[model samples]
Target: MAPDSTPPTNEATAEFRAARDHLLQHRGDIEGARRLPRPEGAYFNWALDWFDPEAHGNDDVALRVVDLAADGEVRAETALSFAALSGRSGQVANWLRGLGVARGDRMLLLLGNQVPLWEVMLAAIKLGAVVIPASTLLSPEDLADRVSRGEVRHVVAESGLTGGFAGIGGDWTRIAVGEPVAGWLSYADSAAVPAPFTPDGPTRADDPLLLYFTSGTTSRPKLVQHTHRSYPVGHLSTMYWIGLRPGDVHLNVSSPGWAKHAWSNFFAPWNAGAEILIVNQPRFAARPLLDAMVRHRVTSFCAPPTVWRMLVLEDLTRWRPPLRELVGAGEPLNPEIIERVQAAWGVTLRDGFGQTETTAQVGNPPGLVVKPGSMGVPLPGYEVTLVDAASGAVVTEPGAEGELCLPLDSTPLGLMTGYQQDPERQAEATAGGFYHTGDVAFRDADGYLTYIGRTDDVFKSSDYRISPFELESVLIEHPQVAEAAVVPSPDPLRLSVPKAYVVLVPGATADAEAARSILEFARGRLAPYKRVRRLEFAELPKTVSGKIRRVELRGRENELHGSGLTGGGESPARGKLEFWEEDFPRD
Candidate 1:
């Protein structure tokens, strides 16, 4: 029996057509679809298979990098053709191969967002070596753990970060990107290697390409394994979500070594044949980033919620950007931020949902209805479901909060294989015939999924479930608030109450007056159970990868309660904070 066929109701967009074509190309053959064979000499090589440097040799606008030097001088880089990058990367690949680096050998890269980083990345891909990108913010202990856990055989890092790997001993080739260091090979000498590289074997699409050490806010970072087909091929959905077109200049504010960096800086734009525009800055200044966007004629822009919050604090209307498409990822964008940006720029901020373990699973695509807080439906070729945490049964009823899960049967290209060296954890994460996302969300009648918070981040107060993200979103609406992280603080009467750790704007004072104003603003917007009961003026703890470590705050709360220091008697200081039950209205 055949399934009932349905007719199209709306005009088919380019993305719809491309997705349909892809599905047709892979239908009834899962193995064939997973192994999309590349033509001979191509063999799933991104440099060769996806991009032909010879054909696009003269296209000088492939990359444009603006370096914000330490001396506050702006060095402009422009018109680096694809052919030049390919040749240089090939030379680097040859040099790395000469250093006894073999196929499938894991190499750790710790560098700034410099040209050498991109060059070495492409080189590693061409050489069929698995890359483990590490953030420069990683301490010596973190570096040692990564080196040991990831089983890295080679290290390529900037000169400044060389001291972090001092005591870690391994039989690994050391290569420095910025300057020549003692006992390390200089990347400048890579030019001496041959400009062409011959692959010893064909790179199968299923071959391991990247191994990411996730930004573990709750626990230790997981070594997430990705295949060649996973990211490069998988991010087609992301390209669709961001509405990237050929020749479009896309600028994303993401540092090197994070998953979002690879998501936007590497795959999404390149897959759409768009020019990658990067502005390397020491710190995130709203004015500078906005000015760069306008000056470069950036057509598309993507950033995390933190940047967006700062951008809203500035006079955004003064800097009218040429941006057509805007996206928010990494963390959920509050409705207030999206509304403000849309009103100022006349462009909607589309929110996307995914993890370090996968590509963009759900996103508000271009030309689609933008639900205020909902992270839109699943992208093409992916299936998303809400399952009960206790029962592990699918929840079809709308508005019911459940654990967000991806179907195990429909293996998407963007998902990582598993957590390396921890099968038990992997099994627990991918249980119940579904890959548990560890995040909680609720699906609407229209299938728009709105994020609640992390499974551990969501807590109960007075027997009512409270999502810190929901409270934080409301708190950030106040103009004085720059960043907010909410956690369940201990309470003797109600068992627990929401406590907000806030970072105020530059001009905003962190006094009782400012606190009272913010509390009033939240009281008017949030529900009785969800209102922030306490506000603390402190910097939020963040992982090395720049994600807010809510777990740290949760631990602090647990400690204060366990030690019997936070319940009844406490003076409210400028830095310290407490709230009364009557602060928020009972109604």
Candidate 2:
């Protein structure tokens, strides 16, 4: 109904589309745009209401994926138009319906970045099924936990990954994509199914749609439940944050099964009617991705800090894609990387803040003046309040730090209902009359929020709070250091001191000289209290998603090689390859 500027048939789509168009029209008006219209309706279905209506006769490229060719210079591309995908998904929906996939049935999707993944996502939405998008990287043990906890009724997995489910006890429907499996139904059969599928009934706005498992870095993964409108409608804020526009070729460097993949791939760009581009390589080679961006005429791009860090290492001065917006998420982007990218591309690498539990709450939208080290103000329809965890005081003064939270009374549309089957955890999240983000940030005088670190990640040194991210940001600015993770090391006098576990760039020396130079660099850039006192040249542990697992490093430091109460708190004997600041001369 909205494709040709016609009136929308669905009340939810009408309300969502209105707010979406408003954000696009007034990209610069953050305050005005933040006052987004809430959907006032009893029933809503994004696939049926938004996608189908918007797909009518639309021939624009909806999705295009590129992989590196053997030559490595050229990209092998596959594209699908909006109308084509709409019809394809419709056929898949009908086929899946015949297989007994019904409304509210929890379906697990275990696949990679293939066309079938997108088709299945749309088809599941059309069939009113709850989808649990899972990474192919998860172990069989992890899959077992998800199956048991998620109450999965059906699973759509690649043929290669079917082995992981062999021992899992369940009569769950098994469907495979690619090469014929002995007992699993083939996804190729959907191609022969008739189109023009019909839904059983209208979907209530609060009906469950997506169930996400948080990437467990610190603890066990939490099951985050989102309604039909929560993710489908909630991503309007994400759309606005990314500065998406109709016909824009938006490329988000995220994989299947992640909330971020759905955020930019399924909802946010579609909310803005923008084309989604996915780039795949046998291994992450920045040149191929760079070539694809230039070849496809990419307009907007979003990648995690890991990708951004890798990208700046390439000779970016040579390739200038037609990118208008550059965004970073999944972690805070270092100022050094942002500066390097801006120097080459002349576009600011804007950072956005959100979680698996919600959509984009805050961001540096396109055209907003970039504030170095800040992850912008709140997005549309979100009212953010920073709360002090210790005293339960609302932190209003600038430069003050607190936990980012949403008041329960004014909950935004993007937030999850709660962690599924975990009442105690959910209770803790909603404790103190606010939905606690568990992450901490500091607000500046101009309302820009600079992310400090996770509540657990932030530590104290000599009664002064130390933000690992803040210190890590400065550490990466050193020419040879590629990545860094800071954790507290026990000390007698200071009680604890900042110690950095550093990873050096390729071919860089991992010696005392390198450590001294890196430490000197950080000491010059950081305050005395924040300076890393102990440095070790070692690899940082990461989740499968490429997030640094500081918790692991903290464990290593706490044990300190199982040395118990030695050295009278002066200092533990320096471990192999570890360097203390006092080991080097001040000169």
Candidate 3:
């Protein structure tokens, strides 16, 4: 089949294309991109309206997955064109409809970075059903919670993971991919169904489309609800942040089930009509990942700070990648890591800031001056502000820190509808005429937003507010440190003091001398008040999505220093390796 020669003529397609083209035209003009009007339509189905027409008879590659074995050899490779994926997803949709799955049904989709994951996502959208994405790394206990909280009416998982849901009691329909499981419908049956799927009804823009369970870094995960327009159209900002162009090969390092996965893996790249590239390895090794990028000629890349940190540890100059754009998110990236990559690859790693509740609200768009430690200006379509947490007053003074908030008066299309089934929590989050991000930051005179830390993660020492991220950024500069998490430890005089949990690089021993070296390194860089008073050499606790759980470290510190009055408490003799500043000499 040849690609469609004629341009899109439908109303929805015209509206979407006009809006998308405006951003592309003004890719470097931030003010012009912000002035572009958002697409407003009563009825829109992305699968039916935009993707199907754009993909019709198109031979361009839509997705490519490279599977790596234990020894870093390519075991298998799969590439699906836009037209092929459209027809396959349509067939899957038809097959799913045959299994009694209907509009508005909640389906729990658990799979890895396989073709079925993309097929099922598109199928669910075409069927007008709500999709609840689940990671394959989830335990049985985690699956049970999602089953209950998500109110899942159907489940589609790999046959190998069917056992995790065996004990999970639910009335949902089971559909298995890979190999067929007993009592579960086989996804292979979808191939027999014909393409050209028809929708049951027109999809409303405000209808619930996706339910995402956030990675609980501080507390239990919250169910975040997104409407059809929130993510699909909202990710225009994300597309711009990544600097994606049509036919570009983009690889985003993220796990399944996380919102970032959907942000980059699905919506962002697809919105730009770019190919979604994946490097599927059982475990992440920097060399194999770089090899995949080089082989695929990936033009755009996005990964978390952890991956960037690991990549910088390797000989980055050895591989000459054709990457034109690079981005880091999930956490604020340190300047040292970004500088190292720039020195080796001559490509600056741009930082972006967003949450599960929204798309790329703030980012360092292409051709912009990226300030050190700043996550850049607000993306187009978002009205970002810094408001005082205590008084709820907007902070106008430059360099004055406050919680990052987005005004709801003219709410951006990217923001989530709200937390599902939790009206009180939702109300609290969106109170004061703004949607609270729960993260803190300060803007400079030039309007670049520098991330501080999460509201819950920031603490005070001697009445001066302290951002753990500020200290952690300095700690990682030391060659010995691989990863570091900062939390407030109890102190009688100052009420609280900064403590660091450090993970050493390979071959570095976790001993008194190592602790002294790290502490002294930090002391020379950080202020006296922000100095790490206590140090513990242990593996940092991380959420399933790989975010550091600072809350857990704070809890551990509180437990160790009961009543917050114990000045010099005895360290635990067993379990985690621990060290302190007093254990070493001041010099």
Off by over 4 Å in 3: 7-9, 564-576
Better of 2 and 3 by TM-score: 3
- Mind giving the per-residue lDDT tens digits that candidate 1 earns over 1-587? 11123312222122323442453354333333334332222236554445443214435466788976544457665456666777778888899999988889999999877888888888899889999998988899999999999899999999889999999998888888776799988878888888877878778777899999899988878889987777877777677778787778999889888899999998888777778898987776777777788888999999999889989988789987788999999999999999999889999999999889998888887777888888887876478888989888899999999999999986865888898999988999899888899989999887889999988999999999998888888988888899999998877777888988889999877877777788888988988888787877888898866689998998887776745543456832223554443554544
lDDT of 2 at 557: 81
Off by over 4 Å in 2: 1-8, 69-75, 561-575
In candidate 1, list every pair of residues with a backbone clash.
none
- State the lDDT of candidate 2 residue by residue for 1-587, as single tens digits: 13455533666678767877888888888877877777758888998899888888788899987777655654567899888899999999999999999999999999988899989999999999999999999999999998999999999999999999988987899999999998899999999999988899899989999999998899999999999888988999999888888999999888888899999888999988999998887788787788889988999999999888888888898887999989989999999999999899998889999999999999998768888899999888788899999998999999999999998897787999999999999999999889999999989998999999999999998999999999999999988988889998877778788999988888899998898898889898899989899999887788777789999988888778335536457666665689988889785
lDDT at 176, model 1: 85
**True lDDT of residue 544, candidate 3:** 89
Clashing pairs in 2: none
Lowest lDDT 10-residue stretch of candidate 1: 1-10
Global lDDT of each model?
0.80, 0.89, 0.91
Q: Lowest summed-lDDT stretch of 10 residues in model 2?
A: 1-10
- The per-prediction CA RMSD against the true structure, in angstroms, equals 7.0, 2.1, 1.7
> How well does each candidate superpose onto the true structure, as a TM-score?
0.90, 0.97, 0.97
